[model samples]
Target: DAYGAIRANQGLYLSSWGQLGASGDQLDLTPARQQLDSAYHLSDSLSQSAQDHNADALDSRQNLKQAGDDADDRYGNSEQLSDADQSNARGATDSGGRGEAARMKAPWLHLASPAGITLSTPESTHLAQGRSLSISSGEDVNIATGKSLVASISEKLSLFVQKAGIKLFAARGKVEMQAQDGEMAFTAEKGVKVTSTEGRIEINAENGILLQSGGGYIRIEGGNIEVHCPGAADLKGAQHNFGGPTSLTRTQPEL
Candidate 1:
């Protein structure tokens, strides 16, 4: 009768007989339902290992708050590139101190100084003819007579014209005269005439020329004469105006 109650409970019905009592009564209920199904599968494997340790501690606190917000956005972009390199080095030192104070307050029209040629005092004086004047000096240039010296020197001018009456006219221009060095006799007190049409004249003197002429073939004409004497060439009507080697005395023809 169910193997006679598993053979009268062979010590809780394992088996004494009953023909091994229904296979030891189903192996005695399989170890008490396998210890209640291994304590309900060890409480569902400790509740899935406590929900995977609370999802790995919330993914390790969101990866430590995204690594502290990427180190505070790289320390605020390095303090805005260190305040834009100190505002471009203080605006290039305030634009080079306002360009050296506008080049020391500007003003110097024209001046050449070593102790000479610095002229700018035009208030009004008069010497207006063709109007052009220039002066150059390395040394010694004195022209003093109410100062109205005009010039058009194409070349060659050696000066020592004192007594102040310089009206140097050279419509064709050629002059070379020298006298003024210890002064044996230098007189142009108001007279030194030099006129030129075709321009050809030469007068080198230790003292001579009290009126002469030219244009009569040998009467002293048309330019070109040479005279150098150590003693005498005093002519009245002339013998070819006493040619060179110096010797002629015939004075007495001027009243």
Candidate 2:
């Protein structure tokens, strides 16, 4: 109802300043957008249609042309492209140039619901970021999967706790941590303790297990316990127990 305002027969409204109002189940922009990189493409050349799609196209066309440069540029230089292909490439490059004018320009999309916003797909939903991806919540952020949730990283995976401690819990299954090709080290400033509530704690090594404190050390290996210290060695217990007979053997210390 304003100057340069237009309304389509399908209940779609367009403002003079390039704002669109559509309440339809589907609003098609294929007439204006081009899918140069992915299965979907958007371009600004179709400006008479919608300003939003035009701006998006302008923003994406640069990347599309850069991607096309790998193949299209070669075709353009080698004189292998047909006339029709050359024309289309020229058009795409022009549109992409317009897109690069506002490089990295992306629309700010806001979707709000009174209850919740749910995104569900039958197959899979993938997300990628050129820089960093961050998710934060005021109350809580929760991720749930009925089957499996996995993450693969090329560098390293790190989790930092600033307030409370961190917890890994499996209600029924086992929780495992392994360093296949490297060392697995757990260091605590205060102290560290490993406990089993109702089961046993087993530390098995293929070679040996060494407990070292200052200049003293206790080595357990080959079904034998060896203790050595530069100072005094004291063993205090109400009852002295041994699996087999104990004997004193004098030999030079390994350390």
Candidate 3:
């Protein structure tokens, strides 16, 4: 048989050999000789405490391997199947072993809701990793609350966009970034611009600052500014003003 069923009119009352119900009544339920001798039979059922006709619970702990690898148990095989045994089983099922294909069904567990479904628990809920956990939706997947959402990472955190670039927007508050003991870098393939609609665009560094492009650089260290250009240096303004004493060691043509 591929499956078995046990139907109850009110509720299902089930427990292990050493456990009891809520009323603490002892039920002498023993396993058969074959069941006691099976490798998958190694389990300790804690208890299933339920009222007469209200709820149902199943508490048990078994060997992890029994749950992970029980394909032989499902097929009523006590041990690993040899190549001949597998061929014989396939021959008994159908032509070209197509009988095995009948066992394959849809592998997804789909949950649809018009009104949503929220999960709430007083204790912690964890998703342990077998491979990885992925979340996807047809439209938007959002995580938002009235309070803050914080993520503390031990290693690096990465965000990638295939088409549209990433955007960080704060409706009321300002956006701030800091690197305590390391460096913060932003690299773009095209152009990079720092703009302020109403306020000023300011760049301040405690050590120094360097703005370089096309083999030229403008280095600002302490109170000194060094400008180097492989091409022509252009200064275009209505008025040329220098607050402090200016000295031009080498004068080149302005273009």
lDDT of 3: 0.45
lDDT of predicted model 1: 0.34
Q: On residues 1-255, what C-alpha lDDT tens digit does candidate 2 reach at each position?
A: 757844343223112222145221122222212222331132223322344322222234454444323222112232333322323333325443221111112321223232455788899899886844533233467889898989889966644443467888889988867777778877777978899999999776656789998989999877688999999988899999767656443353232
The model with the greatest TM-score is: 3
Cα displacement (angstroms), candidate 2, residue 69, comes to 27
Summing lDDT over every window of 10 consecutive residues in candidate 3, give the lowest-scoring window.
99-108
lDDT of 3 by residue, 70-118 (tens): 2122222333333323223443233433212111011222222334557
Alpha carbon deviation, residue 202, candidate 1 (Å): 7.4
- lDDT of each structure? 0.34, 0.46, 0.45
> Candidates ranked by TM-score, best first?
3, 2, 1
Q: Model 2: C-alpha RMSD to truth? A: 16.8
TM-score of model 2 vs. true structure: 0.45
**Candidate 3 global TM-score:** 0.47
Residue pairs in clash, model 2: 34-41, 35-40, 35-41, 58-99
